[model samples]
Target: MDFLNPNYKVRNLLVLNAAGFSCISLVVFLLATQPFYLSDVIGVPPEKVGSAIGTLGAVDELVAVIVAPLLGTLNDRINGWAWNHSRFPSGSRILELVSFSVLALSLLGYGQFATKLFPDLWFWRAIFAVGVSGCMSIVTVMLHEVNNSDFRWSHMAFWRTQFKNHGERLLDGNGELDTDNGGNNELPTVEDDVFRIEEGPTQQTNKKHGSLAALLGVSTGLGAVFSVLFFLTLPVRLSSWYPDLSSKESLQLSYTLLGYFSAVCGVVVVVFAYDCVKQRRLSGHTPDLELPDTTYFELLKQGLDASRNNLRIQLAYVAAFVSRSTAVATAVFIPLMVYKFYYNSGLCGAEDLQNSLKVRSDLPLKTSCYDGYIFLAILTGVAQTVALVSSPIWGILVDSKKLGSRATLAVASAFGMLGTFGLCLVGRGDVYDPRTATCFILVSLLGLSQIGTIIASMSIVSSVGQTVERTEHRVIGSISGLYSLCGGVGILVITIIGGRWSDHWVFGPFLLLGTFNAALAAVATRRG
Candidate 1:
């Protein structure tokens, strides 16, 4: 808790953290609800719904893989001069408004397109993909500013206020009173910096400031959990509360509410999020650690060159891929698997697929979708809840001397296997029986595994960045870009193939996850 006390006020920190939360909420809601949308509204066959999801997801991630890196770079450049002269909003802020507006609008028209979802919704999905990509890019940019931008909005102003309020004692070279501990302020060695998670009170403020950045990464998981527990179940809740509404109308209302919520979140960003580094630059202030005189080309080249033979960086990249894939696949497929289970058991949709609307014809369609929703919400909420809880534990372990980053990743992969393979073997067991308990355990374990990999992978990247930064300044950006690029690629691979396999077997995606986890474990073990 003390670590979260960055130099900035609480308002700015919350606004910055909102970007990550928004990123996951926007993505998770769409994916989590898509199966129901397709089955009930789009009228797609149950057997083919998986492929549709896969194809749509593949295309979505494809756009992300391309746009994220480019847009992130462009946003950084835009923020380079954010609000320098004019009274108007910065270019980056305007871009944010447009991006979130697109996202909000995209969320509104989701199931309304219906059968026209063929090319029309395909095109719309592409537009939505652009919105998603833009939102993701914005998160990256904000995270960069949070980490690099001097850790405050105004340093000298703060000092002046302090001086005016109270007569200051001896000040440090950087500014502000030096909290000296009688010669206990020297920097820690790389071992302590990279491997030790716990920091003493005398550690540098910049190091403590990393707590904000760490929170930013966890925002995605938090967003997913929030979505699963809230947004994904909205339609069902609506159906239960309002008996007159059809399942489709319930879904539409849920989306409508979510769209507005997204817009409001966007407003929060425009109103609250400030340009940290750019404001300092305009004020003729620079951070204590000045921006290194390094170009993007040099950063890219140096990062790439280092990873050419560097096993650690290579493993980090792999970890990033698996971590991102695990997060996304868990969000999309777990609910989908449950939906499929309900549909198969005649609790959702019609028994025949070739005739009338499979999910809406003649049956109590509202009750059916509600039933599936209840199962999915419970399963997904539990998994993501566990994921949220376990994420920081991996962070602690990596920072502890008990397990190095490599060992943590391998161990996480092993947990992944235990969960993914175990679930696959269990297949979609009866939800009402004793096997349900086993299902819950497997879900929790898989969630734990996912978070572990995510923390371990990013920790490895941070470790590699620390090691690589000595030789190449600002190279962390390149390494991080590569890490995200790989993660996007991993999502692409998993959704495309895993989606197809899901039709034949409800546990197909789990099998794919298990295979990927095994590969990650093998690589981490080999590298270790």
Candidate 2:
């Protein structure tokens, strides 16, 4: 529980991971809600709103593609060259703090612009995306390196063995192991007890890694909880904080607060986050090689080559691309969809204005709180709550069983497709009452799928990164950077097209989600 205790590495890791992911969730939550503000408060049309928001994200991704690799490679060099000189030998920790601050300021800048305290500029918002991507890149690399250690591997092996052995017994309908007698009769199954028998690259690499599922679950759960709470109470808090403020100003103030919180959290991480490289040095694992002279592009090329050749890596990347696109689209479009379909927009009167002032709607000066917006917030919160509850379970399955990323991703995709398709149907419904009930169920399912996709894809990337480190002798930072780079590409591809698509059809993004998830399922069926 005491993450500052250096002796408690697991606790430290759990806390650090959670804090890092929290920043990401906050940014994403803000982005998702911004569409409502743009359309309702700023008087932007739905089409333009989606397009503009998508463009903002696209700008971030474009920058991410450039920055992630460069920063990752730079970290490797810093670790090699400045290990003795730097305060935090890893360098990523400092970068993470800086990125978080950048993200925070960017959010504040957006708020300022919206509140007419600053000039309207796309550049400021784009900085937010860049900060997010950079933070993600650094945190991911740190996770890979810190996780790939001998102590962690032992933890994973112990749990995996216990789970696998117990599962085998359960399948055989017996409690005891077979000796001279034949094994208990069970369904035909292929079992890989390779971790027990062979010192393959996976086992070797895992020696440095801990229970990845557990780490991932705890981190993602924290993020989910934070996002849900922050967003759910945002309107109420904003309204309470500044009673006389206009709706735009109120919302902008809320975002500014988000930035402040994120920035403070980032400062904490910079001060207390563990230094994995220094820890390795203390453990007598000193690197003999000097910093690589390779250019950033060349290092990136190596990462790309490894991913291209590794089937599991390629599939993981693609699945992440699809899954993340779905998530981003959901965040940006779902509230807008609710506004279009479920809200009682016709109730725009003096009484409604007074009601809205009390409850708050997405639109400016609308005192009538749209039932749809509240419902969407609740739906989103419920889904995130489910994810927080289920993350640990999914994490255990991924780490302890032989389910692998492929099976996990396939299952997640099934849920994603079903939920998205259901949402599409719900959106098209003629009756609001029935649709409301169904919307809750579909959105909840989507949330579960979101967690599943995250855990599976993350596990795959971590495993692949370790493999590349061992077999290719490449820096895990560079490899992890590549994983993030691929994800950035996914965001770009979806947001650019999806924004336009949503403008045309209210259910277009949902349909697209269903189709993409279906494709993800197909591709993820490959060995991963």
- Tell me how candidate 2 scores on lDDT: 0.62
List model 1 lDDT by residue over 192-304, tens digit each. Answer: 12222334423422332224334654676788888878888888888889988888788878877877877888888877675444344344443333243444454456657
User: Best candidate per lDDT, number?
Assistant: 1
Give me the runs in candidate 1 sitting further than 4 Å from their true place.
1-7, 81-98, 111-115, 137-141, 144-202, 205-214, 240-242, 279-313, 349-364, 428-435, 460-479, 526-528
List, in order, the clash count of every candidate structure.
Answer: 1, 13
> Which prediction has the highest TM-score against the true structure?
2
Error of 2 at 71 (Å): 3.1
Stretch of 10 with least lDDT, candidate 2 = 1-10
TM-score for each model: 0.77, 0.79
- Scored against the true structure, residue 519 in model 2 reaches a CA lDDT of 84
Cα deviation at 527, candidate 2, in Å, is 5.5
195, model 1: CA deviation in Å? 27
Instruction: Return the TM-score for candidate 2, rounded to 2 decimals.
Output: 0.79
Root-mean-square deviation of every model: 8.0, 11.4
Off by over 4 Å in 2: 1-8, 84-88, 114-121, 150-211, 289-295, 342-344, 347-373, 429-435, 465-474
| Candidate 1: pairs in clash | 197-399
